[model samples]
Target: MAIATPQQDTPPSELAIEARGLVKRFDATLAVDGVDLTVRRGSITGILGPNGAGKTTTLRMLLGIIDPDEGTRRVLGHENPRDVARLIGYLPEERGLYPAMKAVEAIAFMGALRGLPLAEGRKRGRALLEDHGLGEAADRQIRHLSKGMAQIVQLLGTLVHDPQLVILDEPFSGLDAINQGKLEVLIRGLADRGVTVIFSTHVIAHAERLCESIAIIAGGRVPFAGRVDEARDRIPAQVRLETSAHDGPWRAALPDTARQVGQFWFFPLPETGVEPLLRALIDGEAGIQSLSIERAGLHDAFVAIAGEAAAARLVTSDAGEEG
Candidate 1:
């Protein structure tokens, strides 16, 4: 195991996951070339990437499921994960509960593996199921629950020990919308208790709303990582506006900051620009029935900083030729 930090003298309120230049290789191919990430002690950190972008590989290394070929990682400030896993919980991409086992028993077993007492683990397991709205499902066999219910069971299993840091990889795959919302609330609640939370998901919009910080992995590397709002500002916020009128003078009458959206003219104004823009729009009768300000986001920033063509190069790269 490689440790980025030798010791944890700092307050435990610091970062939960600190990785620098993490790399993993299988055979001649580099599954994860280089990536740096951090999960703050009480915040939800999101890792965004498409299906073959090495998100899972990076996560596996971070969780100590597999050692990286090169680079350093620390979870809950412990380099030796067997010791740290006592406080660091991981929910793998695949649901690992045994379908033949009762929900309560499966959760208890998972917790006991982390060194929790069996009776305490079972008690906590039942309570967690109730907290997650599945109190009645505790005695039911895993295979008898609905897909969504099973997911909740697995999640409760992940939390039975009340670990301080939780890492979830694609934990929202089969849930319906309502279940997704519940999960979001649960994640936020965990963070509220000062549990550093990190998860990978392709559901960009939902993650965008919940995660204040995000890391974008593209082609085995991190192309973007920062505050979501600041990341958005990096993308060019220019849009060409379109209008139904074939030839409208509103383009010229608009403020100097205006750019084009489609046929309509778009303009970025000062903090005071709102009133003047509306005034100008109404005055010129731009026939502007619709007006929207386009802002950059994780989506636009991903496409801009790392262009689609750049991702294509990585996709066609020999690294994942077999995937």
Candidate 2:
């Protein structure tokens, strides 16, 4: 409930997390392969991947919840992540709350696990509920609260200890559109207050909207990691042109990669530029009805980096999920 103001004294280049060559295996199945990641202090980073892409395993390794079979990691300057556990908060994909526990009690319980005093945790829990418009539900049992309310309570619990770094796994899994938006605002607010955040999600849109940087993983291997803009730059911009004339001399100006669909023509923007193409269209009387250029989105970049098959799997997996 007490959010820290953005710190002017913190260095811009400080690293919050650094991991390299992380590997984890479960029985004969390799859950994570040699992976490297870096997170800047006070930044929101997303581990973007489809279902079964080793996202959870990777997060667990970084959090010291599960030891890596190989590689090294440092969290908030400590070589052993667990050494700084008290400074970190984690919300696992699996949600758990005692049905009989009051909302405030549930939050206080979580904070107590991280070493907060019971009374202090209770005070903060009630304040958090009141701050987030759930003050009326503070005294209600968890079982009596709606699913969305319970989730918000758990999220507040994650922050009750005022952790410097927060790691969330599929935090948006079961929320509806409005709740999802609220979560996005909450995450942004955390980053604004200088709390480092790293979250994993199969959905690309959330990562695109919330993360300045992201790591794209598929089949336990990272295909890309860096700024979201860098990932989008992997592919060229696309051009969509609609013409009144189906056949004309301007057709010669179109790239060989262009494809026709109904009244629309689509292709990657030419290397030279759109000016030459526009001139050709106008001079040759191609009767251009409409033209637009669009940069590749994170979704298109995902398809480019992870391949169409993996992208298809991501779409199918997301479709089956309630959120």
Candidate 3:
């Protein structure tokens, strides 16, 4: 077998971030192995995976926090991200803020590191604080602020230099529901303003609610990518129905895409036929009460793919423990 080589004429750059066969090894273990990612311009791209699923490792290698052993990756049109640091906003899973420094000071310091002018950095910091509802805490020391506030500051510092792409790693961790909602809104607002936002999270709802597109990664590889609906479409559209009687004439009148799960009826339609289904149910006196098609969401897809990998990992871990 012959391996394909890169063509002499490479294609023009159109992606915000492009990675091919990315591999990163920590000692003997491969944290990330042969992952490909393409984040489009002016869109929110989500990296979805379970814990230790190599999402963070992939992010780090792409951002130049670490280098891949044998792969190609480009961030904001640069193969070497370090040179493009000023044009990228990176909110790492771990906070990079100075615990003893004031909120505004820490934010300004990060901006300065990105080579922004001191006055400009300070001005950006102030705007960020005001925008994220942290205006009052701008003067307070980072050590004195709550975790959520500090997180907001970290995010602010990332965006202070007005980077073209924002990479947020687990940005919603340890936050209350309200804070998560605010963060999701902020992320969507960034995408709306034409910033290519790439973020990773264990929280499925955040990814589902905020991102227009997503990549589902597990065991150091992407099982799915592209539009969220495209990925969801890979799984059948399952509409669940609850009826009064265990048996009904509606069963015979079921849509071509219908199936049964115990007493519940599931319809996997190309499109919704809720009205017809409901009418049939009512005619048959099946006492149908509820219908839902939103079940075939990212969560269901993630589970369908990654859940097996996770279960296998658990079984291996248990075997090792016994051994």
Top candidate (TM-score)? 2
Per-model lDDT: 0.75, 0.88, 0.77
Candidate 3 clashes between residue pairs 3 or more apart in a chain or in different chains: none
lDDT of 2 at 276: 89
Cα TM-score of candidate 1? 0.82
Q: How would the candidate models be sorted by TM-score, starting from the highest?
A: 2, 3, 1
* Candidate with more favorable, higher lDDT: 2 or 3: 2
Compared with the true structure, what per-residue lDDT tens digits does model 2 show for residues 121-226?
Answer: 9999999999889999999999998888899999999999999999999999898777787899999999999999999998877888899989888888886888
State TM-scores per candidate.
0.82, 0.93, 0.83
Stretches > 4 Å off in candidate 3: 1-12, 242-250, 254-264, 270-295, 309-323
Q: Going through the candidates in order, what is the number of backbone clashes in each?
A: 18, 0, 0
Q: Which lDDT tens digits does candidate 3 get at residues 127-153?
A: 889988889998899999988889888
Query: Per-residue error at 265 for model 1, in Å?
Result: 4.2
Candidate 2: segments with Cα more than 4 A from true spot: 1-13, 316-323
Indicate whether candidate 1 or candidate 2 has the larger TM-score: 2
User: Runs in model 1 with CA error above 4 Å?
Assistant: 1-13, 238-249, 253-290, 309-323
